[model samples]
Target: MSRFAGRFSGRRAVITGGASGLGKAVAARMVAEGGQVVLWDLDQALLDKAVEEVGALRGVALDVSDPVQVAAAAATAQAALGGVDILVASAGITGATVPVTEFPLDNWKRVIDINLNGVFYCCRELAPLMLAGGYGRIVNVASVAGKEGNPNASAYSASKAGVIGFTKSLGKELAGTGVMVNALTPAAFETPIFLQMPQSQIDYMKSKIPMGRFGQVEENAAMICFMASEECSFTTAATFDTSGGRTTF
Candidate 1:
């Protein structure tokens, strides 16, 4: 048997931003471990492709920032998969890199809406389902920027920091219950999202990491899988750093 045998068999997982990057990686791993996954993302074509590639999976088009859509999506997923056993709130965006003074309020709000409010929406909608089931695992995708603010990415940094705080608070609220909530603070990873960033901004991020390289999606996915499993029973309301030594703290 695999070392992770029975880790997630018969479990149902819902991953936001599951069409690509770290979210997709986690979904693939969960299914490999015998779990069913419901992937929600804004990109319908990509989501459909992911669903086709990963057996025992379903895909839904969703904008995480939209409460109405998220609620509807959650209801559909719960109906199809028999409720969520794990939730990975990974939908986010790295907003434009501009000095705080130059950053447009609209851009900042957009970033916060998707990264911070999006997480809240998912948790708010899904937590009740998990609570009813009497078991759940929640892993919110945060960033090293959340812990240590980056120079040119104020909105992204602040939003992710909010995610960390929110996860901690929720974890505490669910204490003594079977549900567990946690956040992962990852350093730069070679994901498609990086392509959206300017090369100079990317270089600045790379220079800060002591590892001299970007993190792998597989590594982040592995960490997430562990956090979502029954094996992660003890830890909750905590931050797990996968920063490749970028964060000495």
Candidate 2:
């Protein structure tokens, strides 16, 4: 709430996949707290709507899965924001929900490209800017499914696991550089990402949470905001769990 007021004064942030769901929620909070944010997503229409709704600096539509597009978008963002102080690599997807043997080859690759590689591209292109500025915070949105792989969601699980690993590696590389990197591993949240899943799978995930309910977008945004803030300093190559007692490790 108002507690975040002025916390991000004069800060510039970029949220990949900010068109909706957790990304949008994070963007809104950043702006509300005096941060200027650029929203990135694949859907042009939704991107426009979110930018308007969130009062972001602007919205850029690009496929996070494409390295070339990601590179260009990063350039555009750097130019637009005059140098990003924070990066929230939240762009991702939940691929087909089927047994590993039944998972489509195309689906697996697509999920990995967006959920994992997309994060790398964002961090790769932006971390240097933070280093140059001598300050930065990177929050990569992963999932509990990575820690404990969910059945029939091999691609999503694998991609998120990669994210967790990547965050650790990047954190070590940026240690003591005023650039902190961390991963957020959350259980199922009632976001649009759930639309891609089967009801059975959704029920299965809910059952895993001790809270017996899905996380709210605001709840997710709260943890992410802290991770992306100066308050999160001294923590890197680590994961912040928000799984409602489902994952203690």
Q: Pick the candidate with the highest lDDT.
A: 2
**Candidate 1 residues 165-209, lDDT tens each?**
999999999987899999999998899999779999899989988
Flag regions of model 1 displaced more than 4 Å.
1-5
Q: Can you give the lDDT of residue 27 in candidate 2?
A: 95
Q: TM-scores of all models?
A: 0.98, 0.99
RMSD of candidates 1 onward, in order? 1.1, 0.8
Clashing pairs in 1: none
Q: Name the weakest run of 10 consecutive residues (lDDT summed) in model 2.
A: 1-10
Q: What is the lDDT of candidate 2?
A: 0.94
Compare the candidates by TM-score and give the number of the best one.
2
TM-score of candidate 2 to 2 decimals? 0.99
- Per residue, candidate 2 scores C-alpha lDDT tens digits across 1-249 of 558798999899999999999999999999999999999999999999999998999999999889899889999999999999999999999999999989899999999999999999899999998999999999999999989999999999999999999999999999999999999999999999888989999999999999889999899999999999999988999999999989868
lDDT of 1 at 55: 59
Please give the CA lDDT of all the candidate structures.
0.93, 0.94
